[model samples]
Target: MSGVFIVSDNILSPIGLTTSKNFGQLKKSVSGIQKHHDTALSDQPFYAALFDQSGFIKDSDHKYTRFEQLLMASISDALQNSSVDAGDKKTVLIISSTKGNISLLETESYNPTIQKRISLPASAKLVAEYFGFINQPVVVSNACISGIMAILTGMRLIQSGQYENAVIAGADVISKFVLSGFQSFQAISPGPCKPFDVNRDGISLGEGAATIILSANPKNAQGIKVMGGAVSNDANHISAPSRTGAELCQAITKTLDNAHLLATDIDFISAHGTATIYNDEMEATAITLANLQTVPVNSLKGYYGHTLGAAGLIESIVSIHSLKENLVIPTLGFNETGTTNPLNICTDLLSGNFTNCLKTASGFGGCNAAVVFSKQ
Candidate 1:
């Protein structure tokens, strides 16, 4: 099997519209999460990282939904920066999102026509057609792990000789339904989230999109590769994560084993630090279980809030750039250790020669996923 390398990428978020711009902001410790009082989203004030629709709009004809608009903008920007031809017969498109076009359900009444429009496959095909993709578009919507799962899906397809190139895009937007659902669970933080911090309470929701283009050919002689990945499920409660980190540890160990690397080989970890009580504790337990407790870890939730589906890919992109730039970004809102197992959380920017990094994500239904990225 051939190695899958990232050729080009773009990030469309409140912080920036390009990957470089987002990385720059992270280096300066800037955050996109802010307090907003929008009655349309919630009756009370809430904090989130959201794009102003009027200012972020690229489509003049309004032919697509907000979700589709994000995917097209991100994909177009990424394609412009890469030589990969998305219209080629050997190219495939993969879309990842927990909720696609779900906002329409709030505005429009439920009907067959509206239902078809909101389907993930339907929205994926429309975006694929707009971008001239010939092959069927693959959709990954496994809760919050959708982003990493989608990336792994693309890597497998390329390694299996099914496609020469893959454009994987992941996105999600905040809506009334989404806000209320989190509110019902009392999961929305009153202010910016504090991942792995003693003061942390809940997650601050966010909206954004990111696109990562992968190809069998390296972008350069020393390009980054999608080395290996693994997924696991605890079969625990649907909404709550595992009481113990044993299952997530299985996924991490398996990923390291698949990559032919030991726990000490990893340079750092880009954790799925949602700032919620159980999630942070479970992730810490898992990392310690894998004998990676000493590895420096950071969470972007403080900067981007919890972007849900986009969280995994967005954080992974930052980590990739960190390797290329030789700088480790700090965890924005972390001040003290709060989990049962202590973690070496990066609190300040550190310069070093990084080679490999681990990206992990856990979502609802007790599902957990892990993927290893290496610089060759």
Candidate 2:
């Protein structure tokens, strides 16, 4: 396979709704989550991560879903920071998300059926055309890991000569539908999420998007390269993470094997630590099984809240940026370590010269993924 380089990275999180603001907050340990007050049915008082940046496109005639708006803004920022063409190029756009227009599901009254909506793909198409991309792939992997899957697919397409370049985009927003869904699962944490913490309760929902540009070759000598990646399914549970963590470990193994690297070569790990007791415990075991203890690890969920389908790409964007800045931001709100397995909630961004890095994520539908990124 050919080398796939990460030409650019951009994250538009609630902590800093734009690229500059997001990076500013990253320098500090600021988080954007707080008790959501806009909805009446959300009685559990869920923490919501809402953006502070103004919607990039502003005009009475400009109309778009909140998801599209966030995605467009991030892609714009990513291109601005990259050597790749965002203005006029035959770029392939890959979009991933879970609850697309569930934000449109309105429970206006005390009665009526909750609507089943799917509008993310069409929205992505519109945003792609607006962003100057001539080609696009709409991926609504309703499965949680769909976000990272989008990034991986984009990297592969570029690496395999299928496309000269590709832009991977992921975005998701909270709504009554998503909130009620999490409430149904009782996965909404009233308190701050503590990934890998023993007393970890559950996830907090949020809205955000991250976009990365991948080229067949390095766009800038400074970009990170997508050396290898792997995906697998546990087939052991519907919503729960397996204690065996075999499938998760398999993905990591295949990824490192393909990259011709060892666990010891990875300087740090961006974990999917969702803060749920089962996920943290499961990931803790998987990391040890993969021999990742010597490498420091951290989770972004505590900082941005869980963006669902958007988590992987968003966090991956931050990872690439971390490689450029030479710092791995600490896991916000992570105070204690709880799992029986060996895991570390990195409390600070250790300064040093780093090169190879790993990112892993596990989600519903028994989906799991691991990716190897290298600074070129």
Please name the candidate that would achieve the greatest lDDT relative to the true structure.
1
Per-residue C-alpha lDDT of model 2 across residues 236-294, encoded as one tens digit per residue:
98899987988899999999998899988998899998888898888888888898876
What stretches of model 1 exceed 4 Å from their correct place?
55-57, 219-222
- Tens-digit per-residue lDDT, 83-137, candidate 1: 8887899899999999999999999999999999999999999999988999999
Q: By summed lDDT, which 10 consecutive residues of candidate 2 come out lowest? A: 108-117
Q: After best superposition, candidate 1 residue 19: deviation in angstroms?
A: 0.4
TM per candidate: 0.98, 0.92
How far residue 342's Cα lies from its native spot in candidate 2, in Å, is 2.3
- lDDT score for residue 302 of model 1: 90
